[model samples]
Target: MKPASKSLWKKSVSGRVMVSILVSATLLGTTAACATKSGTDDAAVGVTDDVIRLGLLSDLTGPFKAPAEQQNLGIQLYWDQKNADGGACGRQVELVTRDHGYDPQRAIALAGELNDSVLAYQISVGSPTSMAIRAELEENEIMAIAMSWSPDLGESPSLVVPGTYFGAEMVDALDYLIEEGRVAAGDKVGHIYFQGDFGEPALEGLTYAGEQNDIAVEAVQIDPSITDLTAQVAELRKKGVSAIFLNAAPPQLASVAGLSEAQGLDVPIVASMGGYAPQLLDTNIAATLEERVLVVGSVTAYGADEPAAVAVRDLYAKSGSKVPPSQMVVLGYAISAVMDAAMEKACADSELSRDSLWKVFHGDFQIDTQGATVPLDYSTPGVSPSSQVIVLRPDKSVPGGLEVVEKDYAGPTVAKFLDR
Candidate 1:
């Protein structure tokens, strides 16, 4: 496969380089037949008489390592149970994991190495890394469920996004603040964000919603490498904004929250799901987070009464894991359930080829995660699978150190944003 075009990558918006993919008769033709054959003469590459292999691209040693490791555990937990229960389509599930350490170039190389050997990538961890490898997956006609979400990924049918993108999440979060009377029309809202894929989309959402609500949006773009957010928080404080929105990593969040409290910014702070971690509750800023920060995400929180949440919790206990609870684990298990359903569809069709599996998502196949998230459908290109979001606040007593403030929220701004 060709290396992603450097010129295109340079021009890509907010680090999101997208392929203008058109999935049609030609895409589903001989390209799929060219896949490596195995198992009863019709199985695709990565499928054997006794195993079906899926790839894992994660950031095990980088900034997001904590949550990434938990997600990997969740992925493994799902397969372990499936393999124990006689597996999917009568074959045990196998994972081919590669740790990219949050590096984009490393992710591209790792994805190339696994392109021809796995049925699909079960998880691709970070926004930048996922963006980096997307073109290669399209070139190889492989499918992947990217844990990162960007508007760019929506354009490709080959990459499945489990829920709405960061933009939608941010939009709903702002609306949640408005509905809860934290902010109102004509108020000024401050936003602190990273410079690339993850933060840009969220900033866009906040800007759009601000316009609709007649609120002035004050945005500060920060480099991810910067851990001290005292200046940013002080700047926003000087602006006298009513609320603050954040899109960044956990450490950055710690800095912002701590500094905001020390400076008496005294405003409600909301963060994108990426901006938090369960471990943050053990830090000096723990009380501040619980008192002020709200996190927006699509999946149910850990220890929720939802059935899938309970199942994953049981699995974690059975495995004797010392890792603290995380919502990423539930997401890992949910995406695996989606992958299993697609493969099962292909098996029932009597043609377990790459094309058959890919077609399931493009057809009427719907993914239900039993309350892990809203039901998902991937048939429409450039569209989010679900707009529903769950808002949570930090609570040390909670199993995940977070509890839901609102569930299944689809505020008008977000609903309209997704509609467009």
Candidate 2:
């Protein structure tokens, strides 16, 4: 079961009948069906005669590395496990990857590389790159499973993201927190976010949720270039806020987490998906978080209840991830599942085109809101899941999500108002 709060994706190769051809990516993006192209090994565009190829462009060493590396590993692992066992449709799946350094320009070039190799593509980690390559994606009609929550990107036909916009989910999370008394009524809310379209949606989600819920919310923009967070934290504190939401990358996220702990503010330090510290799972740092500063997370947290997730941790240990296992690591496993399913669909339909692949990426699917109580089925068109999110706080039994919370609060579907 994959966790909600966005995801990265992948699949495997091998165990398939050899097509006797090794297609080159340069001629792979031709839209029309290649009933017969040429170059038995390097088929021209639209020419499908075996050998399924996949391309992944992720932030290998940038802000998104933590998650992207996991995604890449998961994809590699899936291919390794599958090819050894047999790839989708008995046809070997080939995966090619490039490091984007989380730069948009690099992402654009990488996108071309991806299009040249496979009919479908999965771009993970960071929205800057996603935004940079958005237009090109549409022009090329590449099938994608990116992990950003920007609503604007959703409008494009090529995108196939898990669930829907994080904006709505954030609203749901805020409402759940307030109604549960996690926050008091009329309390001031402050947000510290990175500037750009990447951070815009989360801020919008917060902005919308607070407005609709009657909470006073303020925005505090932080430049990635800035090294410290004292000024921002102090300013938000001055606003009389009882809680603060952080929308930033690793650098700023670490700064915020460290500063908040050092400041010793009583205010809750709520975090966006990006703000949660994936590297702090094994450190004493988790113990330092303000008691109420829980970050929002999907059900795949390091402490989730599922056995599969447990298996993922074991795999992490076996594979040797430098950073102790965390929710982000498990998230890589989830992305693999999604990609595997997409690959299967691509092979089966004989339509290795991106448009065809998107048609079945999630297998007529829906996620249970990242493993929520009630299954969110996105199998049908226009229908998707609305899984629950959990609060990531220190001293809590679980790091984040409802994996360790009382059963009732584990997810949005698991109501806390049963008596009512």
Candidate 3:
């Protein structure tokens, strides 16, 4: 028999006590007039008259613990604001969180434990971890907002990703490099990436773009446990690479940048979204990042003057957080924003089932986060909502520590990749 869903509730509630208190208070006030019902009594797995529970499977004790925590903060902030304004269908939002430590096995186990207690998963971190649980999610008809950008997840109807996939991002990055004259048709480019599912799509994108542009691409793989990338950088440098595309973590990206500088290789460094972290600016490689790094992503940076951006800043300020929010916060906010829209639509339809939520997401709906991110459309399954990616350069002067270099850049390569 499947594990009891409530068994996981205690674990979920322990780590986020403060946020839970704030959420519970707001929920009581806002949902006071709504009739109470058991979560499993009527429509869906995790819905009731007074509450809608969502699950968050994160990497709180792993390599991505810090960013995952920031993401959780952003998700909490979004739901808090929504509950304050009167939650969806008169029900307050609640989160059931579990830490998987970026382990696929742990993620699978946690999914089994929480699958029956939540309406949907708001955030599931890591590519391989998400993939491990994808089958179970689909079997149960559970909707999830996946944090990974692996293109394979795009094919799963039960999953939705906020931004363009790594492959598409790499395609756009290569196209940008070519257009800017940093690389040419015959120039050799180096791609340094993680070895598994997380980096495969990016490698595919780079390879496709290279074939299209007649550029020679060389690849170097890195294990997730290896912290130092000096040898990889040296190998790429020896190959006479004109530019480097990084599909690794932020720290690894920093290591590559620092090692490259130490080796006197000064080519442009184009990084996938995984390489972006606001804290990277505070590191010793800040100057190197400013001079050479360009980050490509689908969401707007945190410091933009747009409505969504302003809202994020206001949310952080209101939360009384001592440190400033990061790009991961923006990412979490964006995911929650999209999920909120779907929930609202489902509630309005008088059916808050998983099927109803799925219909809402697949109904050609456009989510506008008021500049916090590029608008997303979920009309088509297995396809990215937006083809455009925003490119940002590190700038200490900006409040978010990065400034937009290009907005909505739709490179020919990404368009081609999307078409295929």
Q: Which runs in model 1 stand beyond 4 Å of their true positions? A: 1-39
Model 1 gets an lDDT of 0.78
Clashes per candidate, residues 3 or more apart or on different chains: 0, 18, 1
Least well predicted 10-residue stretch by lDDT in candidate 2: 21-30
Across residues 278-366, which tens digit of lDDT does each residue of candidate 3 receive?
Answer: 78888899999999999988877788766666677888898997655777787787788777766766655546778677666555566
RMSD of candidate 2 to the true fold? 9.3
> Which tens-of-lDDT digit does each residue in 90-156 have in candidate 1?
7778999999998999999998889878988999987778888877776666788888767677666
Error of 3 at 11 (Å): 33
lDDT of each: 0.78, 0.55, 0.78
CA-only RMSD, every prediction: 7.3, 9.3, 8.1
- Cα error, residue 309 of model 2, in Å, equals 0.8
lDDT at position 25, candidate 2: 13
Q: Which regions of candidate 3 are displaced past 4 Å?
A: 1-41
Write the residue-wise lDDT of candidate 2 on 268-318 in tens digits: 666665666545534555555544556664434556665545555555666
